[model samples]
Target: MNFSEMKDQVINGVKWYFNRNWNRDDVMNMDEISDEVHSTLKMNTRIIISMLTAYSFGSSVGFIFNYLFKVEQRFVLRLLVGITIGTGNLLYQAITTKDRREIYTGCLKYCVVIVFSIITFFLLETDTTLRMIVIHSVLILFMGYLVIYSQEILYNADFGDIDYVNCTFNVFFHFPGIMIHATRLYLQGEQQEEN
Candidate 1:
């Protein structure tokens, strides 16, 4: 291929990779709505598990920081905890998945979490325990809403049930442990299909 053709192919590939429909709503029929409902339920369960895992992990880290270390600046410590969790999650995902889309989504989620963590931790002047709780809660809530909203947008985009304007916000935001669960689910589905 010539240089111009190669450049066009690269551009098209990038567009196809990012713009691919995840839920496959275009080819879905009414009979598959039941299956979609089941899948949605499973997704919700995974999301809840993700939220709880992140909350518990953050709490444990905060406890360790509080009792073990005598750091005067608790807020900075809490911020460090968030950074550690986000970075660790992103690194783990990058190591495990060869899928570029998954890695990109993971990075996007990490960035959102870290930005929110910084804002919440620095702006709020609360006690150590309360600050930790508030920050974790905020992050969990934000991620949960983003995932659900994105799912809805993707699912309904075909039928025009949702506003197209909101389609620009499509994202797959996973919390600390969520990517592991998602990967497991993907693998399990592949195995079942193969069987």
Candidate 2:
């Protein structure tokens, strides 16, 4: 083929290749689109890691607090608070429309905890001290999951007009309770396996 005709054919082939591979509109702005996708993914990943770290940390901290702070709640209740955060993180990870890796397991854990938290908080009527601790734990766990970690950060970030607190509160105030809630299930699973 003549040089000009060969060049024209090459151009057409390049365009076709790109068209098949990416949304035509996005193809031209691949960098921008990629940046957006990366940002979202990064946000999601950070929240997940934060949840994991916070739950683990809170469990230990809670155990210590029970002894050191003379906190009104029982040691077990504090531990339960940590488990609640972990479960909420897992559930948010699970139920989130974007990713399903942790969804099912997370949901199961969350539901169990929610039920337990409700019983502990209301049905049991254990004590004033225990009840407050339980309530605080539950509030932090799920609310933290919603506010921090992943979902709320991405969308619906507003938490009932409290001046849109930073992401830190999202995890601290809420997910710890989630970990506490999940701790029970984790124990149950281990017990079942042991049996």
Candidate 3:
């Protein structure tokens, strides 16, 4: 399937998993919310990362690029982007990794982001800007869907944290969303514990 389909599947999958975890009985518990601090870092991080990956197909990057291109050298802009993305991923891994595999995966993901950012800069011609932007816009929303849904699954998933591959994806795309979902999941967990 195409990128849109893949993005939708990812987003929907996360949502579907979360729906199963929403804990209808504890939807409004206050003390139950503190569990956000103890929630699993894997899926919490993954949902954020994938959203950024999907957002590459969205206009946000292009918009940033366009604005930067106007005032800076293209090469400089690209270098900054690569460093920013890589550094962010590295910091995240350093802070959250549990084992060798996590470190390896984190490095691989940063490499991919840097590579893709370069390729995208070269491949996207000026005339086709609008089309790419529209496509990315849709992907951003799709990624958002995945993020919200995935967090839901954190509370309900039998296996859990299936998408912990990319860290930067979430850093750039979800910002506070990952935290919001974490809060919700923890709150639900708290409620369940009370009962």
Candidate 4:
């Protein structure tokens, strides 16, 4: 195929992949939904409590690690640990729910994030301008993904509900830890330059 045709095929493939239809058993007609399903659909208070507790605990651990432990140098390790904890929680939920599609997506997300985090470690020692460019590139890619593929990422396939709570959970859980590490790295770099 010619170059333009090949590019079009690739773009169409990606669009189709992201928008692939799911075959969730939970999608039933209103008349087909069992009374048990309706009865069991009360508000889940435990989810709210657990999320708050997890975020609080994660933030406290981040504060302690930054201030108490004095383990300031290995920023990548902190980020890796944070991502691991958050992703582990997601995987656990996917498994407990027995949703194969979500399990697959969660695993994919974990792998991609882990690989990106490892790559970030190598960039730590690079020159300032190069580092900034890489960071900005990552930011742009993330924002673009959010803008273009938000529906796939944020919606629940089975329920057609906007189920992005875990994303907020991960952000609250991971961002602080990573930010603390980033701040320490910046300060250390400044001190070294002064010396």
Which residue runs does candidate 3 get wrong by more than 4 Å? Answer: 1-19, 23-33, 42-126, 157-195
lDDT (tens digit, per residue) of candidate 2 on 1-195:
899999999999765433321122221221222344434644554555455556555655545656654554444555555465655565455334343324334545655665566567665566554645654565445543442234334332222221233444545554544344344445766787799
Model 1 TM-score, all chains together: 0.28
Better of 2 and 3 by TM-score: 2
Off by over 4 Å in 1: 18-36, 43-195
**What TM-score would candidate 3 get against the native?**
0.29
Clashes of 3: 12
* Global lDDT scores for all candidate models: 0.47, 0.47, 0.47, 0.42
TM-score of each: 0.28, 0.34, 0.29, 0.27
Distance from true location, Cα of 119 in model 1, Å: 12
Each model's RMSD to truth, in Å? 16.4, 20.3, 13.3, 18.6
> How would you encode candidate 4's per-residue C-alpha lDDT over 1-195 as one tens digit per residue?
899999999999755533423122222111222333222221221243245445545654655655643434345255435444544554354335434345345545654665575467557755443443444354344432322222233223324343347544543344443344444555766787799
* lDDT against true structure, model 3: 0.47
Query: On residues 71-158, what C-alpha lDDT tens digit does candidate 1 reach at each position?
Result: 3454545555664565456445434543435534664677676666556655765455455555566555555444434344335533
Model 3 misses residue 156 by how many Å?
2.8
> Model 2 — TM-score against the truth?
0.34
